[model samples]
Target: MAEQRRRLDPAARRLEIIETAERLLARDGETVRVEDVVAAAGAAKGTFYHYFPTWDDLLDALRTRTFEHFDARYQLPTEVDGPIDWMRVLDELAAAFVGFTLGQERLHDVLFHSDFARRRPLPADQNATIRLAAVIRAGQEAGVFAGLDPEPTARLLFAVLHETADAVAEGEDCERSLAALQVVLRRALAARPEEGSAQ
Candidate 1:
């Protein structure tokens, strides 16, 4: 067992360190140190360095991992039987965003409010905006939503959800914030009468 443990794959070892760090961060907040991560992961200081060149690099990896996990939880369905209820989808996304943020308040703060997270360039494809954009595009194509550009509309909705999440994190009511967000989204995305007549 000892020898087998010694031969763990490099990628798997790296993941172990990251996961261990996450648990430690949850328990200790930003006070978790590299030594703590190495001890919890059963890795040497050198081993941690092998995967993460610096402390910031590890934090960045954690932020990306957390964001990806958050995004995966709120994905809109790809296939539907008929005209998609874009409003319902937006509500679901808003609720999920609020739920995740409130549930993981400490981790969310570390990942989203940290300086590293702010400085990181969030690629459109890797973030929630892209998924929302796809749904908006589908709604537009199906004539169920306004004919605004999907990317910008998606970004606007994403910004609203992001701010709502932040508010919920800061002790605001989740349901109220989510309802407000849904209201804004419904109004903005609703197809205008003139637009329907034009179509």
Candidate 2:
């Protein structure tokens, strides 16, 4: 007789399904099906549906989760009392972003370069653009960045970063690309003498 499997808690089951699905996605790229995830997760089809209504929904959740992980890893320091070093902060953020992209190429492609990504609008609160916008706003207040509006500037920076990340993911030299990108970002956002130099 076969041994019986222990039942998983709802939260544990959901997480198992997401993790299983991610593994399958990494192994099979975007061609992975919901049935494949169900089998890999050792769950019934209905169980998978209970947690994620559709395949696209699961993909979106995975993308959001990935971004959350990245955010937690590179979150800005909020406890500084003195003047902020905006240039250093930006450099740190850029390095972290590029490093994550290079290290998690498959996940990065799924989150930012997939067909589902093209179809759905990303949540603003969970997006890197919003986080970068906050940094830009802080720089403006600290007289370390140009007086341009933060939202558009952040969006443009995000766009540039996304493109550069994609290129790196597709086999470009990460260090060279990141260096060029940093130069572009600094040039685009560098404050004038009247605004206060980042130095």
Candidate 3:
């Protein structure tokens, strides 16, 4: 007798299917087929259609999921072990972003650099810029960042991160580029000392 596959609820089943497709996409690029995804996920064709009515719908979900994973890596710190080192937080965020971009090269390109991506951009609020601005605002409140407009500052920093990561992805030396980027970011955002502090 063959072992039975455990049944999953609607939400779990949907997420499982999406994640399975994500793995396949990462492995096979745009050449990946719906049948390949379903077969690999141990899901029926009907089940896939239940979650994603069309192939494009699945791609959209995949893009959203990829961004979610990227955002989760740099989410605002809810709990601190000790004094918050905002600079270190920024550094870690930059490093994590770079690591993800490099580690998931094919997936990143397929989801973000392809023609399909140009046609469908993420909504404003759900973008990485918004998340970075939130971090900047938190840092400003903590007195670690200067009194700069968080949104614009985040936009600029995001551009820097994006371009630098692209450079690394396109053959620039990762260590050198990343180190320079970190220095540039820290210097640009560091809070200045009080003007009259010297006695």
Candidate 4:
């Protein structure tokens, strides 16, 4: 049998409890309870109470859980070596986001519709800045992007990508949305030379 790991500190225990509770929430839907969380993590009610004083606190924990989660859960593939085209990277990222959203729609609805988005602010690591930098760098090298502010461009990319999920969740034509977004991305990232050419 594999050895069971243990946490020694109170703070780690509390985080463990929160993370375990999130798993229950993800797996059991809305039926999960605080007792279930304490029981599963093998922590006492005292520990749970110390971490979160009331139902609201637990809900707060859940919100933080959702925020950290969406950042790490569906990250881009690591095997993609040798820099790829910016727009192509966006295409892959869009598909990944849509797929991840669809898979986690139930939990996502709880997080967004219930104001969980407001609980945990965006973390630096989860900021998508590095991903954006990668795309911007590649586009620059390929001579397809110039006179652009990479950081803001990344933010803009995120806004456009968010629309994909909105269309999907609204039961609109998802494929049409994806296609339309792809075109928009291609235009946004298209090369612009220093000298003007006749239109």
Q: Best-fitting candidate, measured by lDDT?
A: 3
Candidate with better lDDT, 1 vs 2:
2
Whole-model lDDT for model 3 versus the true structure? 0.82
The alpha-carbon lDDT assigned to residue 15 of candidate 1 equals 93
lDDT of model 4, residue 35: 86
What is the per-residue lDDT of model 2 for residues 54-126, given as tens digits with 9 covering 90 to 100? 8888988888888878877887776467676888888889878878776664656676778888888788777
Q: Model 3 reaches what TM-score against the true structure?
A: 0.78
Give TM per candidate.
Answer: 0.79, 0.85, 0.78, 0.62
Rank order (by lDDT, best first): 3, 2, 1, 4
lDDT of 3 by residue, 67-128 (tens): 77776666757645666888999999988888887777677777777767777887776687
Best candidate, TM-score: 2
Give the C-alpha lDDT of model 2: 0.81
What TM-score does structure 4 among the candidates reach? 0.62
Poorest 10 consecutive residues by lDDT, candidate 1 = 75-84
Q: In candidate 2, which residue pairs get closer than 3 Å at backbone N, Cα or C atoms, i.e. clash? A: none
Give a tens-digit lDDT track for model 1, residues 132-153: 8888887777677898888888
lDDT of 4 by residue, 134-154 (tens): 767667776766646778887
Candidate 1's displacement at residue 46, Å, is: 0.8
